[model samples]
Target chain A: MRKLYLAGAGNVSKNLLSLISNLNSDIKIMGIENSRGQLFSEESLSMADINNFMKSPEDYRKSLNISKMDFDIYVDMRTASKNGERERDDYINLMKNGKHIVTANKSGLANFFPEIGKASSEFDKKLYFEATVAGGLPVFSLIRSSFPSFTVDSFTGVVNLTSNFVMKKVNDGMNLEEAKRKAMEEGVAETDMTDDLDGTDSARKAVIIANSLFHKPMRLKDLKYSGIDENNIKKNEMLLAKISMNKEFSVESRVFTLNSEDPFLRLAPMGMACSIGFKERNPVYISEDMDGPLETAGAVLSDILSV
Target chain B: MRKLYLAGAGNVSKNLLSLISNLNSDIKIMGIENSRGQLFSEESLSMADINNFMKSPEDYRKSLNISKMDFDIYVDMRTASKNGERERDDYINLMKNGKHIVTANKSGLANFFPEIGKASSEFDKKLYFEATVAGGLPVFSLIRSSFPSFTVDSFTGVVNLTSNFVMKKVNDGMNLEEAKRKAMEEGVAETDMTDDLDGTDSARKAVIIANSLFHKPMRLKDLKYSGIDENNIKKNEMLLAKISMNKEFSVESRVFTLNSEDPFLRLAPMGMACSIGFKERNPVYISEDMDGPLETAGAVLSDILSV
Candidate 1:
């Protein structure tokens, strides 16, 4: 059986545990580590233990014995970091200890890809991050699995569900703050909405896409992005991220109003969609109707299985 | 390096050859077998040789030396067989000779899955048939790569583009015969449109989907399907294939009119789409704007690389 050690006891990790419990999978969760500390178990954790951990994660984090834990994969469900230093260090350390990494956290990959890539290669460990970009949309997975030897010329998508929901609500006559508050209430927006509001989240995703798909080394600082602002927001406008390769790769995330007949305009409030342009064939469009912790957990599970 | 042997020198096989020519792939086409005879080459065929074969496939089939040919993968792009006897025998022979099978022919798998399944297991060789259903839509690839442990409950789709185009044209006041002729002229309908028009094509695809996705063994005779007829086809009606798993697995293909608000109804003329219902999650919708031999060749190439 493949053993998994979750790096964070948060919503995505809890959902992943529950999801795994319902499936006839060969995966087992042997440990969970949060900021409080770490929890290790010799055998796979049962549903009752998972429930207890969910109820009081702090109490379960009493043991920080990492050297004794025998796990094959390290799952990172931690919250996004601005600088990604802590997540990068954690990933490198875990990889150095002979653990494959499956991550939903984007910041570490977006900010310090060269270091992480080098470490992963040097350690001969695989890394899967399907949930980092468009949660559960299978953007990276599709490209990796289906489009072999096909050159991706560009990618344009509405990848941020929180900002998309907020913009749609604002377009429906709600004020900016009210729209954001409604999004938060509906679990569409995170408690810390600064990244979503300032386009940093979308930019980070664009950076990852460029790095992975276009084979271009990019960083968050290389992108010039503009998020939704009350003064500049337009009716029917939503955040869009575009990554293209010409003479060089360009990544941008900006608030733009699509034409009335544009398919991106038809996406649901929580929907995420992408149009991928290939070298000589017609562009392929992919979209999902919803995005959340559950969906991200599903993506994480997919990566785990792939690992 | 992978050596691929084409079982048919048809449109899809020719397209696959050309597509591989343009890519920096590690795959090589070592031989091609047609109804006339066989063409064998010790070295990988060049683009010029591929073009020559395309011009007059019969001229290149001078040798029937299958015993001397050394290839790793066998790709089947032959026309649909009504009974699938020949294709089944060919697949078994190839697998027995230690060759992995990748096919675009649906009839063999649809009609003789048990034999093929047993041979594949006995030989311990891989079988990739992504091009058999939905062309390049990546339905099977997505399920294989992304939904590892998820239970697929049902699948509904507008899979046959020829029938869809013919029905749409007839709905616009054109007679059924003229619409079918137009479709053929547009390269959407095949010269032998019996299988496509009589719903056998859709039923075969339904059988493949049911067997592959639901893990239920099904055959074409097990399905009750109706094709597009001038007297029976209603306005805005198109062929739809539905497969469900209840007390037992059920497969059906029939002509039906989708509501105007239905997303499947909004698909382009040559588009193919499928809605996959999972056990406890939201259904995923996948669609492609176009389907043809080139797209099928793309899928075939993908399978070759995977092998």
Candidate 2:
């Protein structure tokens, strides 16, 4: 039986625990850690115990004793860290301890992909982070499994769900501020939508895609991106990440307005869409509906199973 | 190094040979067999050798000496057989000889998936046929890799490229016969477009999907379907495969008209699309452009790499 150590007690982690509990698999959640503390058990934790722990995490206000835990995989679903230093250190340490890693956190991978990737290879452990880019879209997995022998020439995508929602509202004639407010009220945008509107979020995902797909050591600082500002926001415009692999990987996150009849523009407001261009083949288009934490957790579970 | 023995010299096989030649991989084409003859080589066959063999197959018109060949994988890209008896026997024999199988032929798997699957499992060999349905769309691979722990409840797709072409032409104010003729002229429809128009091809693919995805032991005879006739063909209507798994699996192939603004309707005329519904998650939408033999061969190569 494989044991899992969850590194967050947020909604995504809660959804993952619920999914695993209902699934008829041998995977068991051995522990869960949050900002306050952690809860660990040799036996698989039950849903009730997990819920209670989430309700009163202060009751278990103690740091995780990593050396004493017996787990096969470490799942990171924590919120994005500014510098990713803490998450990066945790990932490296976990790999050194002979544990596979699965993550939904983009900051760590975006900031320190090569370092984390090297640590995984050095420890002979696998790293899976399908949820970090487009939630539940299977972008990385499709590229890995379906195009194993093909060369990816370029990629273009609208991966930021929050920005997509805000843009759709703005396209429908609402002002930018009003649209952003509506998105937050509808739970479509995070409370702090600064990174999302400033193009940092999309740029980070682009960097992750380049680092993983093209094997380029790219960081967020290496990219020159422009976000959705009120002055630049147009009626039918949306933020897009355009990545090309020539002599070097060129990633640009900018705003573009697709034709009205374009299929990519027809994607749902809460959907993520990407078109992968190949060397000598027709591009493959993938679109997925990103509802909430459940979908992200589903991607996380998919990565877990892949590992 | 992996050695591949192709079972056809058709367009898809030729495309596969060309692709493998250009690919920088360890896979080598060792032999090719068709109704007219067989060609074998101890060393990897070059593109020139393959083209020459195709140009004058009569020069190499001899039965394949299976026992004398050294190959690891057998790729079947032959045209669909009526009963699939020959292909089934070949797959069984190849598995017995300790070789993995990759196929782009649908009839064989549609008619004898259980038998072929059983042979693969019994001999501890792998069977990959991503090109059999929705060529280059990555349907089976996506489900296998991305939804390992999820239960697929149902699927709806417009997978028949020829029928889609005909329907689009009819929607554009062309008669059925004229549309079919144009498709044939453009090489979008096969010389024998009976199965494609009559829904047999779509039903065969539906059966294959059921047998593979749902693990159902189904046959074509078990399915009840109706072909597209002049009276039945309507404007904006296209062939759809609706498959559901309740207490038992239910598969139906019929004509349906999607909304004008529906994203599925916006798919390219030569594209294949599917929406897979899960038990407790948002459905996944996959669409791919099926330009021709090259795309199908790409899927076949992906399967080969997977094996």
By DockQ, who's the top model here?
2
Regions of model 2 farther than 4 Å from truth: A1-3, A22-28, A40-56, A61-70, A121-124, A173-178, A231-233, A246-249, B1-3, B21-30, B40-56, B61-72, B118-124, B175-178, B230-233, B246-249
Instruction: Write one digit per residue (lDDT tens) for candidate 1, span B73-94.
Output: 9888887777998778888988
Question: Which TM-score value belongs to model 1?
Answer: 0.90
Docking class of 1: medium
Clashing pairs in 2: none
Per-residue alpha-carbon lDDT of candidate 2 for residues B224-283, written as tens digits (9 for 90 to 100) = 876676545676677888898866778988777777766667777788899888887788
Off by over 4 Å in 1: A22-28, A41-56, A59-70, A173-178, A231-233, A246-248, B21-26, B41-69, B172-178, B231-236, B246-249
Query: Residue B274 of model 1: what lDDT?
Result: 85
Q: What does DockQ give for each predicted structure?
A: 0.49, 0.60
Q: What lDDT does candidate 2 reach at residue A285?
A: 86
Quote each prediction's TM-score: 0.90, 0.90
RMSD (Å) of each candidate, 1 decimal: 3.0, 3.1
Q: Tell me which residue pairs clash in candidate 1.
A: none
CAPRI level of candidate 2? medium
| iRMSD values, candidates in order | 1.9, 1.9
Tens-digit lDDT string for candidate 1 (A1-307): 7898888878888788878888888898888777766667888777787677767777864664463469999898987777999778888988998999999999899898778888899999998899999887788777777877578989998888888888888887898889888988988887888888888889888888888888787778877898888555677677999988766767789887788767787788888888887775566787777767777888899899877
